[model samples]
Structures are given as structure tokens and as C-alpha cells.
Target: MQFIINGETVEVAADIRTSLLDLLRNYLGFTGTKKGCDQGACGACTVLVDGERINSCLALAVQYQHRNITTVEGLARNGSLHPLQQAFIDHDGFQCGYCTPGQLCSAIGMASEIERNIPSVVTKDLSATSVMLDETEFRERMSGNLCRCGAYNGIVEAISEATVPAAAAKTAGRASP
Candidate 1:
């Protein structure tokens, strides 16, 4: 299968059903994405697929063919950390750091989703002209991601402090996971 990992293009020969998470950690040697709750209940295996967050544990390696996959390690640029990563660090977003990777990737995607006006279950008054970041919207979108470290407060703060678009931030929220 051929896929773009981080910013590199590569090809691999593996079982079609192998999870992208396993291929990344075992075969590709990129272990940033964690394998918590292999059933996909936990967002530990989260990765950005074509700029959207997907639970790698639930996705097959073959399914990623020709798509861009961004793991926790991919968010950095030329040795510089992504803004979200820096924000997480600045806000002390993690204790154990096991779930930090997924949280970061999910935040980027969620922020984009909200910026694009994608409504979530908690979007009260969806008919409202703009999506606003509030406790309710933040919690609903981030419900899938979990943090055993009890760093929810800092995580939320980090995302809230990120440089999301002003229009997006008006409606999209940074919720605790």
C-alpha cells in the first residue's frame, strides 16, 4: 500500500486488514500514536487522515492508500513543534502524556471542523448564524477523546488559547476530554 506518512511518501507490503496503528508503530517505527483500547473506544490511536482525525485502531492500513497520514510526530515542522503542541506544553496539557498525541490531532481537526461550521450534537440553536466556542460545544466534540492523567483543565485551556480563526472561535469550543 502507498500512503503519505507525515510529509514523506512511502510504500509498504503488509496484511490488508492490519490496523494503521500497528503498521505505524511496528512496521513503520512511528510510535507516537498509542494503542489504548484497541477497539477504538479510546482516541489514543487517533491520527490525522487527510486533515481529519481518525482512530487508527479502527482503520485498516490498506484504507489509507494514497491518503496523507499525520501522526503525533508529524505535526512538527523542520524540527519546530506545531502550535497546538506548543500550546499543550505551555499549558501543561499532560501528566502521563500517553493520550497527548491523539488529543493534539483531534484538536486540530475539531478546530477546523468548527471553523467550517460543522454542527455537533451539542450545538444548541444550530440555526444561529455563527458557531461559538462554549463549554457545551467543546465538550460534545471532544467526548470521544479521553485523558487518564486528569489534565482536562489544562488540555481545554491549551486548545482554547490556540490560534483558531476568530469566526471559528466564536462558535467552536475547546472542551475537556
Candidate 2:
């Protein structure tokens, strides 16, 4: 089967029942997306499927044929770290780093959702035309990804710094100048 991963098209022969995570890590050698739990309960296997985040453990390889698959390795561009990645470093968003890959991907996808004004569970005004990236929204949107090192504060701060505008972040005290 053919898969488009990290802006490259590659073909691999695999079993029909292979999970996307298995296909990525085992077959294609994209080991950045870790396998913390085989089940989707843990967000360690998150990846961007056509710019949207999905739990790769629960997805089948065949189901993503011809679609854009972006792993943590693909987040950088022109040899520069992605903004969120840099933010992660600046804010110490990770410790053991096992969940950093998934957190990065999920945060980027969540930023896109916010750009489109998509409402989350804590969205008080669905008709407000714009969703604020406040604490409630951040917590609710990022609840799925877990960090065993107890780095939730840094993760939230990093995401807020990267996704929220500088002025807004300053107003909310989410990021440094």
C-alpha cells in the first residue's frame, strides 16, 4: 500500500490489519510517535492526518491511504523548529519527552481548530464568532494528551505562548514578552 508521510510518498507491504501506529513506527520507521498504550486512552500515538490530529493507534494503515500523514519528525521546516516546538523548549514543556511528540502535533491541530473558531466543550458562547484561547479552552482542548512527568503547567504555557498572540498572551499573562 502507498502512504504519503511527512510530505513524501512511500509504498510499503503490510498486513491489512496493521494499525497506523504500527505501520508508522514498525514499517516506515517513524519512531517519533511513541506507543505508550496500544489503546487510544493515551495520546502518545497522536499524529496529524491531513492536518487534523488523530490517535494513530486506533486508525488502520489502509484507512489513511493517499492521505497526508504528518509525524512529529515532519513538524519542522527549513531546518528550523516549529514555533510550538521552540515554545516547548523555552517553557520546558516536556521532561521524559515520551509524550512531547504527540503533544506537539495535538497542539498544532488544536491551534488550527481555534483559527477556524471551532467550539470546544468549555466554549461558553458558540455564536461569538471567535473562540478565545483561554485557560479553560486550553485545558479542555489538551486534556487528551498526558505527560507522565507532571509537566502540565509548562505544556500549557508553551502552547499558549505559541498559539496565542503576543499581545493577548501578555494580557492573559500566558507568555513572556
Candidate 3:
């Protein structure tokens, strides 16, 4: 299969049944995308495909031949960490850190999703003048991710208050870590 991963085009030998998580960790040595439960039950395998989040453990690598795949490693550019990564760190969004990568990718995508006016099922007014981020939306959209360390307060705060937005950034900054 041919796909662009982390901005590089690479050809990988994969069958239709090989999950993207396996191809990344076992075949391509990209272990950042975790294999929690291997059943898509957890969001540990979250990765960005065409700028949208996906659970790679449930997706076949061959199915992504035409997709732009971004693992946790791709979140950074040149040498600096992505703003989301830094935000996660500054907000103490993780504990054990096993789920940090997935949480980061999912948070980045979640922010973009909200910015694009994508309405979550919890949205009370789908046609509201503006889409607002709320706890219900966050919970519904990110329900797949499970943090055993129970750092959800920080995790949600970091994502909800990404530094790019001054208002939200202030929220996270003023929030207790």
C-alpha cells in the first residue's frame, strides 16, 4: 500500500486485514499509536487520517493507501512540539502517559472539528448561531479515550483551552493544573 505518513510517501507491504496499528508499530516501527485492547474500544490508537481522527486499531493499513496519515510523531514539525503537545504538557493532561499520544491527536482533531462548526450529538441547538464547546460535547466526542490515570480534568481543560485561542488559552492558563 502507498500512503503518506508524517509527510513522507512510503510503500508498505500490507494485506487488507492488517490493521493500521499493527502496520505502524510492528511493520513501520511507529509505536506512538498504541494498541490498547486492539478492539477499538479505547482511543489509544487514535491517529489523524486526512486531518481527522481515527482509531487505527480498527482500520486496515491497506484501506489507507490514499490517505494522509499522521501519527503522534507527526504532530511536531522540524524540532518543536505541536502546540497541542505543549498544551498537554502545560496543563498536566496526563499521568501514566501511555494514553497521552492518542489524547493529543484526538484533542487536536477535536479542536479543529469544533472550529469547523461540526455539531456533536449533544448539541442542544444544532443550528445555533455559533457552535460552542461544552462538557457534554467533549464527553460525547472523546468518550472513546480512556485515561486510567484519571487526569480527565486536565485533559479536557488542555484540549478545550488550546493556546491558539487567547480566550481559551487564558482558561487553561488560569485553571488549576
Output the better candidate (1/3) by TM-score: 1
How far off is residue 116 in model 2, in Å?
A: 1.0
Ranking by lDDT: 2, 1, 3
Write model 2 residue lDDT over 1-177, tens digit each, in one string: 999999999999999899999999999999999999889877999999998999999999999999999999999999999999999999999999999999999988887787777889998878876776677777888888989999988998898788666324323333231
Instruction: For model 1, name the residue pairs that clash.
Output: 131-171, 132-170, 132-171, 132-172, 133-171, 133-172, 133-173
lDDT of model 3 at position 149: 95
- TM-scores vs. true structure, each candidate: 0.91, 0.91, 0.88
Q: Give the per-residue lDDT digits (tens) of candidate 1, residues 1-177.
A: 898999899888899989999999988999999999998887998999998899999999998899989999999998899888999999999999999999999988898787677788877777876666677877777878999979999888787777454326464443333
> What are the C-alpha RMSDs, in order, of all predicted structures?
2.5, 3.0, 3.5
Candidate 2 lDDT score relative to the true structure: 0.87
Question: Which model, 2 or 3, shows the larger lDDT?
Answer: 2
Residue 119 in model 1: lDDT: 81
- Name the regions of candidate 1 deviating beyond 4 angstroms: 163-177
Clashes of each: 7, 0, 0
- Pairs that clash in candidate 2: none
User: Where does candidate 1 have its weakest 10-residue lDDT segment?
Assistant: 167-176
Model 1 vs. true fold: TM: 0.91
